[model samples]
Every structure is written in C-alpha cells, then in structure tokens.
Target: MKEPYEKPLIKKVQVGLSNKFGSVYGRHLRPEIDGVPISDLVSRFGSPLFVFSERRLREKYRQIYQMFSTRYPNVQFSWSYKTNYLDAICAILHQEGETAEVVSEFEYEKARRLGVPGSEIIFNGPYKPLSALKTAVQEGAIINIDHFDEIYDLEEIAEELGQPIKVGIRLNMDTGISPQWTRFGFNLESGQALDAAKRLVSGGKLILNGLHCHLGTFLLEPRAYAKAIEKMVDFAYELEDNFDLKIEYLDIGGGFPSRNRLKGIYLSPEVAVPPLEDFAEAICDTLLSKLKPNDFPKLILETGRAIVDEAGFLITTVHASKRLPDGTRSYVVDAGVNILFTAFWYNFKIELEEDISGPAEPCVIYGPLCMNIDVVAENVQLPPLPRGTRLIFSPVGAYNVTQWMQFIRYRPAVVLVGEDGQVDVIREAENLNDVVDRERLPERLILKKS
Candidate 1:
C-alpha cells in the first residue's frame, strides 16, 4: 500500500544574457572546467592577475613555424626577447627549437642564462654597449650592427680582441611607409647601406655574413614585405658581385600582427588582414624568384607579438558601476593602464564569464589607477555587470609583459598555465620591500629613532 501525495507548484525566474565578444562558447562565456574562471582565479590569486594559456601559446608558435617551414626549406624563428622575455616563456620556445633574438646587454645575458648557445642567438639592435659587443664576439653570436658608430666600435673591439667577429648590417629600405625611416639602420636608397658594407669589407676588421632589414612593426600590408625582400636580395647580389662575399642569412625583423583589432577599425576574423600564409608566400616567392640556388640564405624571422599574443589573458574584478551624466554606464576595474599599454593602440575585447539576466549597455572601462588616463576601454558594449563581477581581456601576451611599468601602483604576479592545466607563478607580485631593496637610505636621513 502507498500513501497519497500532493503536487507542489514551482516558480520560474527570467534571465537576460547576451554574448558581447562572440566567444567560442556560443552566446555566453562559461567557467572553464580546468582553466578556472575569472572570479575563482581572482579569489585565489587576487585581482589583476595575468593568466597564460599554454594551449594557445603552443598552437600559435606551431602555426608560425609551419607557415614558414612549409613554404621555405631553411626557416628559423629567433624569439625576440624584448617582446616577453619571461624565462618560462623563452624556455618553452627554446625547448620547441626556437632561437633567441636579443637587443641589449642585459637581454644577451638573459639568453646566455637560459642556456641558449651563442651560436643560436642573433643580437639585433641599434645601441649595443661595448661590453655587450665583447661578450657577443667572444660567444660567437651574430651581431647585427646598426649604424656607422656601431661599425667603428665593433672594429676597434675586434682589433683589440685580435679576432675577426662575424657581423651583419641592418638595412633600412624606404618602403614608403608611414613616419618614414627615422630611426635605426643605414638607408638603402641613400647608398648608406652599400657604403657601409663596402667599408666593412675593405677594412677587414669584421666578417660580413648577412643582411638584415626590419621594415616596421605591425605591418598591415604584405606587399611591403615583398618589396623589402626584393631589395634585400638585390643588395645581397651586389655584395657578392663587388665584395665577393657570400651572404649567409637574411634576417627579416618581426612586426607580425596579432588577432586583436586596432582602434577605430572593425575587422571580422574571417577577413584576414595579411594572414600568415600571405607573409610566407610573399617572402618565399620573392626570395625564390630572385636568388639562385647557391645564393639561398637562411631565412630568419624575429617574431614576438604574433607568437605570444593569444597566449595571455588579464582577469580583473569590477570595483564599481556607475551611470554618467548623459545616461551611460561605466564599470571601473581593479586593473589599469599601468599594466596594459596595448589598450591605447588596441580595442581590447572584454567578456564576462557567467550568464547574467541583464540588458547589454555601452560602457567605459576604467582601471584602478589614480590618473585620469587609466581608462582601458571606451564605448564598449558589455552586459550589465554588478560590483565584484569578473572581466577577462584577451590577446595581451606580447608587449604588455615586457613594456609594463610599475607606475603609481605595483604590478601583479604573472602565472604560466602549463599544458597539463597546472598553474605556476613565473613572476610574483611586487611588494614594498621589493621596491625598497633597490633604494638606498641616505646617511644624513638615517637618524636614531626614539
């Protein structure tokens, strides 16, 4: 026998949810099962923490490598140290067989510390201190000399060391780009590059092994690279004809764009602004069509941004929400311009990790910095979020890490999420003692305290 039961009525609640960035999880961002949510990660590591996705990093790196290797036979990527320079990140790249590209003395030492052999490192920059030149020469690193001053300095250093150092000259070709060839390297059109090469060969103090040209960074047009490659090949031929020197490599400096959208420009993901395939095709086709089989030099790329941009994410907490005088909503977060310099140049897409029953609203995102210029996003469409809600900014893995300044506020710790989904703190958050360690107390100010 069974007892009789009564049914109870249940009420349903209406919720409003919308996808702002068109995240992969359909219309709503959800908490990743293993990657951890913005809120949970913040609760554990505090706000304004940087989280790196190992999956994304490896994927991007492989894509870049394949793009060039499939098209050209001899292709190598020298990871630009100035882009990120995190030992963990560089270690990952080096483990994947990528070489190191260093600019300064400190970065050269860092590369050496990372166990990157001097033969694998390519030293490129305009200003290399004498000490750096000496170390590079001793280690057999390929030194990319920038100007006449550098040439003289290196010649003197080589003479003093009693050994000829292998060097390359950075050629600045006029590709008719914006802001027009103002910094670094000798100009090709002005015959400065030719003159410099001739002088170096005639002086016999240094060995000229290659030609380097970095047209510009974040180059949007593939044709610019094609033109630059054509010019470089011609220069290589001229060097061979007159100086009887066989150039060993052609270093095409890195400026590849990431997936982030530039400010004031709206582009769909499918549009493909100078896709990786296009760059490979242009560079390979130009080199293959221009140079002979024996003249084929090792194609070296110093890419930083494109390799690591998609790997980084910044998770922050909403400090407050307010309405402007004109009826606009604004959300202030705990992170700011001190860490995210790319916000000035990129329209960083921000998204919520949970479903919310609120209408979408236009808002300005502000950081916790005291300066008025600490805004992260202006006129961004985001779902209505309450205080303490978490927001995630994507595609910030490149310049932000190296360029971030500890201005007005201390920077946050950086964590590298391993491929196995384990989080490791690569850099710890700065503290008062960390800053004070570099500061010395004046003897006059050191008085006995009562």
Candidate 2:
C-alpha cells in the first residue's frame, strides 16, 4: 500500500485587524544577505550565530556622516560604546575616524586600549569615580559634568592635580517631548544648568567648553530635535553672555531610531520611521539660523544605534513546533531573551531561508530558556516552519550584545562578513570554562564525594 503522505492542518480564528496573508513569499524575496546564503552561514558558523555586515556598517556611517557634514562644516561623530561595545564594531568606527563616547571607566579604558586618544574621547554618564575623573582630566578627555556633585568632584580633582581642566555641562531641557529624561543632566528651564556654569566659571578650576544634552533613546520625531537645537542655541548664548565663555562644541547626543519595530507598534518600522535626512535637516536648519557664521561651534553627534543596528542579523534555528491546547501555534527556537535582549521591547522581523507556502497562522516564538518571560516574538504570522528550519532576525546591531544576560547557555560566536564576502569570527563562542574562569574556590569547600 503506497499512499502519499498529507500534512496535518489546523485552523486559526483571525483577531482584530490581522494581516491574513502573513509574510508574502514572492519572487523578490531571497534569503541571501550580502550575496551569502543564510543556510550557508548557518551550516558553517552553527545556528544561533550573530552575523554583522561590514558593508552595511560602512554604508550607514558614510550616509549619516554625509547627511550631517554637508550641512554643518565642523560636524564630528563619536561612537557611543555602550550601544555595542564589540571590539570589532568599535574598531570599524575608529578606522572610519569616529571618536569614542564612553560612559564608564571600563569603557573609557577600552577606548584607550583601542588606541583612541583621550582628547578624542567624550567621557559621559554619572558616577565617574574620582580615580577615573583624575585619569580623564589628566589625559585630556572631554568630561561632561552630569550634576552638581560631579562639578564638585571635578573641582576637587582639579585642585589635587593643580591643573585646570576643560569640561562640558550636560543640560536637561523641556523640548516639549513626552517623558523627558531629567535624570542625567542639569535642568535648563529651572536655571540649574546656568548655575552649574556659573559655579564652574567662578571656581576657576574647570574650563567650560561644551554643552551636552541627550533627549531620549529611539526618538522618532524630528521636530523634537528642532526644538532641542533651538533651546540649546539660546542656552549657549545665555551662558556666553553670563560667563563670558565661548562654547567649543555642542553635543546633541544620540537617540536616532533604527528599523526595528517596537513591540506595541502596529505598523512596520520602514513606514513609521522618518528618513535620516529629516533629523539632519531639523538640526542643521535650526543651528544655521540661530548662530552667526562667525560664531559657528563644532557640532558633535553621538550616533550609536542608527549607525549599526541595520547591519546585524541573528540566525537561529527552529527546534520544535507544536500546537497549544488553545489551538494556537507555538515555535521554540534556540535564541532567547537572554541573548536577544531587545526582544523584550522590539518585535524583530524574522525571515525564513527556504520558501514556505501554506495557510499562514499566528504563532508565538518561545526561546529555549525555562523562564516564563523568555518570549522572542509575541504573535507573528508565519507559515509552517517545522523543526530544523532556519530563521533570520534583522536590525539587531544595537543594544542586544551589550546588554545580553548569561543565564542558561553560553553566548554564541559573532562573525563579521567583510565587503569581499569573507567571514571572520570577531567574537568566539563562549564555553563553560569561559563562564566559570573568574570564580574562586575555597580549599575547605573542596571535598571529594564518596
């Protein structure tokens, strides 16, 4: 009896405003990135691999640089290290002439180890220990004072070192943007930022050269930047008038959105996110109008996410697929929130390597972690992706690697595909020894069991 096998089928009731067609498998879709097949990458590097494209990184950097440089004559980009501190990524930015913007002493040391001069590094964030501040001040790094205490700390350090240091004051302003980030810097509206400047000038311990402000992360509206630029210009003028100080540079700080769609967002990122030109235009237009040609200060931009997010791809394999008791489909994959931390906030777009055609059903992707919160995608419409199927998650080049937690499994290797299609392992996969190497064992606790 030679009977043909038939696939098992299940029906799902569509919910509110569902895309019934699911992912359209069309002729234009090919699962090759940078001319290399996804299957080949998986087979060679192993599943749950992180692939970064050098071409994409360079292209994005150049695009952003051109966009801002064409408008502002003295535009400088400082790569924010906390976003993605992989040495390879930082090296690329350094090679492309980007200074490093580090928030911690560890990150500051990392930049120095990478041969980034102290003068080129922008040391930010609160909680810079006295030791770190002394090193930064002595090494000539641009330290942006976060609060009054930091100003006092720098004053003490300047006194101890017997050398006056140049510094910038991080300002917090009301730009009419929702959910303002007031925790980082001095408040501008309340005149606290001006007071900080006055203190610095009166102390004769630090040289105030720059004004820094980071509005927020993942900013989508360009108008917010416009308003912030206007306020910054006005504030700089006021500081110059009050303290008789010339602002050397204005650090707008990074908040540019990538192409990853937020979890609660209905529309895809491509449609929702504004182009890079919009942000540049908003900032450049405001600066050009406010400052005279003779008074143009060097513009510093700390662009982290927008420069590298689209260049990263995560390749994971589907380990198991099953139907829940409630008639909903579920997929278990090797990658989880432990590794792909951005999954908690972003609904990352997943693509299948092979052609999948059938009645697409809504499925929830679960990571291999045992925790209840280890979900990757809440609800994505996809066709039947059985066991051993490979799926690629895109635009994950930002915070995932830097903030990934090492809980259950070892972190995987990260490979960078060169412009010539040559793949190199930039970060090797961690082993059990790598995880436990830093542990200390007590002799009294080391006993042999019978």
| Candidate with best lDDT | 2
Error of 1 at 403 (Å): 0.8
lDDT (C-alpha) at residue 166 in model 1: 85
Give me the candidate number with maximum TM-score. 2
Compute each candidate's TM-score over C-alphas. Answer: 0.91, 0.95
For candidate 2, the 10 contiguous residues with the lowest summed lDDT are: 20-29
In model 2, what is the error at residue 25, expressed in angstroms?
8.7
lDDT of the structure predicted as candidate 2: 0.89
Model-by-model lDDT, in order? 0.83, 0.89
Candidate 1: where is the Cα deviation over 4 Å? 1-30, 447-450
Q: Give each model's clash number.
A: 1, 0
Error of 2 at 41 (Å): 1.9
Give per-residue CA lDDT, model 1, range 200-241, as digits (tens).
Answer: 998899889898988777778788788889999999889889
